[model samples]
Target chain A: MTASIIEDRGEGSPRNGEADGFPTATPLPVRTSEKGEEENPSSILLGTSAEDHHIARMAALALGLSVLEAAIPSPLPGVKPGLANIVTLIVLARYGWRTAAWVTLLRVLAGSLLMGSFLTPGFFLSLSGALCSLAVLAASQHLPSRWFGPVTHSIFGAFAHIAGQLLLVYFWLIPHTGLAYLVPIFAAAALLFGTVNGLVAAHYLDKNPINHKIQRHREMRPDCL
Target chain B: MLSIAHIKPGDWLTLLLGALLTAFLGVTLWQGGAADKAIIRSGGKIFSVVPLSRNQLISVPGPLGISQIAIHNLQARIASDPSPRQYCVRQGWLKQAGEVAVCLPNQVSVELSGKQKNYDSLNY
Candidate 1:
């Protein structure tokens, strides 16, 4: 049906081409005039992919929830799953850092627009953290081949990534004079939240949950399928 | 029964040494100039900085909400509609290098830069 519509609109593969040579398969080019603004499954599929990108970003926002921030009481502020970091990490690990960086940038742009404001500073702060996370993920991949546990690796990386955000907080956010007091609070919170996310990521890494959750999508594409 | 068999002494050492070094660095950064991060909590809400010390807190009639600010040497262009008392006004003064004053209610935030610079460039 979708192929037929695409063909009808002159946007699909071509007129002479048959998607599959089967008796019931309509030659995707059969354009009938009555199908005005009728829902095209092919276009809807493309629209769905854009929606998936939006969903991924919403997931990023969900992970960022904490304290009075997300309606759940987290003892820390600025705490997030760093899942988006993990998303960027896996993308870098499998593809390469540059592509993962682009993914991160796209996710931020999409996430911010879906969130409805590029003018706000929070989005930029998140963009900063994502950039730093990408940097850590890229550099850490080349480290010496050591007998590794995924949990420990995650802990180390997660902590480093959180620290990346801290660097921005310390060097850029706080006034020149206010560093003495802020450190204690942020440290206390980082330790608390970092351990939680580290353990969660570690557990997921151990179980390879990322494969189950996200890996299924890429396979759904026709080329992969 | 302890098993040294599971431990790659080098990897453990690296992880340990790296975490310690990072912690030390974090603590150092925290201790370096961290004293100025004053989180002002008013009526059970947190505000980054509100410059006016005397009027640290205020209540807004109806749903527009309340706000606070910390004033140091920072100039702010606030969207006055969000009752400033909401999440935006509580982020008081953005006078520090990397400190961000967030007004979530207004979807506004004032970010402090390392050096005081022209925000007009940011307009573009």
Candidate 2:
């Protein structure tokens, strides 16, 4: 259905082929009728749509936040507020899971590179945590949205992130049973930080509710689907 | 669009799970039983084992110097050490299984373990 709409729009708009850059390579019938306005054409030549640009911009923002977090001195090695995840929650809420996944992966990759911890144990731990949290966020989508807001998603993601890191630490790094004693402390930290992150995300979402309508429009875009 | 309203059942479920996990871990740590003996290790090797039931002070030599470990009344503590920061001495006592006091500069570590020991490794 969406393909047909894009096709119809393609036939009507002379600017579609112009935006695509490689107009002569693939010629199609062009109708003279006009209706739809021409969307941003820069993405067509770049092979990346406006939505991709948006994702990249958000990913950069998340990376900046991650670097800022790393700059802060922490007494405990593993304990962090994980504020970078706020961008993930916002992206998930506004753009859905796929965009959120892209932003998160990019943040983890680029953030680690900027911090000079790429391919190190720290990178692996961050990757594992991000992956687990993304999985949780994806799974949380099935729940009724009326009840599960950014706060709930944030909490679940935070706990899963910690649990994933702990599992890796136990099996690969330490392999000692004594690590169990610290579980309580870690869990408590997870709970506290999760709630804090959730509240921040929720507050941001509340103030910027306009993104929901814009995201809905983007979802209807054929290239996005 | 996602609702920004009161907490839902799913939120409660997560909250409940996190609370339950925290509570379980807290209880286990709080109820950590007394250890029968304390194991002293130096340079990653077992230096000595002192029974906590008997009151005694033993000195173990390591890279930095000797660290005196005192065991008495089902508790063990670092009595004295030559390390710059008497961090191990400040650790006070290890009455529960899974507790550990380490004088890292001296390469001496004291850990409590029993039949019902809770931990297999002390990370810090």
RMSD of every prediction? 17.7, 9.8
What is residue A112's positional error in candidate 1, in angstroms?
A: 3.6
DockQ metric for all predictions: 0.07, 0.29
Write out fnat for all predictions, comma-separated: 0.13, 0.42
Clashing pairs in 2: A177-B120, A178-B120, A178-B121
What would the TM-score be for candidate 2 when compared with the true structure? 0.63
Misplaced by over 4 Å in model 1 are A1-69, A74-76, A81-83, A89-103, A113-117, A144-146, A149-173, A184-192, A209-225, B1-15, B22-124
Cα error, residue B74 of model 2, in Å, equals 12
User: What CA RMSD would candidate 2 show?
Assistant: 9.8
Tens digit per residue, CA lDDT, model 2, B1-124: 3233535567777777888888998888657776899999998899988788899999999887789999988999999999998999999988888799999999999999988768543534
Question: With candidate 2 superimposed using the best TM-score fit, by how many Å does residue A98's alpha carbon deviate from the native?
Answer: 1.1
Candidate 2 residue spans exceeding 4 A from truth: A1-46, A211-215, A218-225, B1-13, B29-113, B116-124
Query: How well docked is model 2, in DockQ terms?
Result: 0.29
The superposed Cα distance between candidate 1 and the true structure at residue B18, in angstroms, equals 5.2
**What DockQ class does candidate 2 belong to?**
acceptable
Q: Write the per-residue lDDT of candidate 2 for residues A135-215, one digit (tens) a residue.
A: 988898667888777778988898889989989988888887667767788888888788777777777767655444454
